[model samples]
Target: MTRTRVPALGAEGWFTLDAETPALLGDRCTACGSYAFPPAGSFCRNPRCASTAFATVPLSRRGKVWSYTDAQYAPPSPYVAPQEGHVPFCIAAVELAEEGLVVLGQVVAGVTVDDLQVGTEVEVVLDTLFSDEDHDHLIWKWRPVAAGGAG
Candidate 1:
């Protein structure tokens, strides 16, 4: 199936992981060579650093699950949840070792609250959150990658 939703590519001419290629985009500090995922728009988020300089970088697709939880209830408004028949979903914080950062996102299709456990290794994927009468929103997701293989 093809998804029409187009997510926010990036803040300023940088590329984001979306359909066909799901990868986290980030920034690297020129001074200390530290990486920042989700691309710090204004300045470096590093506590010890005091520089605004950064360069675009792509994160590894594969990561280990740092933590996770299921949403038994629908998230509050402005969240864009389903209008009726609310269903529980899972969210996870994945740790990319190459970037040394944790990115939180939704789980991939066929993955449920029962199918997940802490510390499971997963790979990133692009998925659609929901499409209403007005818009279709694409978002990053993750699923268990096959052993020794990219998902």
Candidate 2:
């Protein structure tokens, strides 16, 4: 049976799934040229800039790992564990090459904290966060750029 793919609710405008490559949709300040993910709206996040105008732009795909950790405990409600139950997952803070901003996300499955190090090159990709009978809920994940980099 075929399942429909959908972004995890609340992730609609935060990323693009139509491109040859998946990209996070960020916003560039029209006045001071600053950038923010989750698309900074209403006002520029830059404290020095008072501009409220922004242009939606695709963010860079590659970055270097800034920090990482593992979630050994399952989160509270609203989070759905897989069929295998609550397994630990790695989380990484990656500094986007062009934006100079560190964005946090879950590392791809099968990768452990021991496999990552600060400065490790990584890239963003869309992955299934969870699956229901009719849909595959998706979200962005970080993966090491090198071959066999996952642990």
List clash counts for every candidate, in order: 0, 0
Tens-digit lDDT track for model 1 on 1-151? Answer: 5535567333233336455666777889988778876677668777898888888877898888889887878888667664476677788899888788898888765567666677788887766566765546667778877532332
In candidate 2, list every pair of residues with a backbone clash.
none
Which pairs in model 1 have colliding backbones? none
Model 2 sits at a Cα RMSD from the real structure of 2.2
Query: Which lDDT values do the candidates have, in the order given?
Result: 0.72, 0.86
lDDT of 2 by residue, 50-72 (tens): 99999999888889999999999
lDDT of 1 at 72: 79
TM-score of 2: 0.90
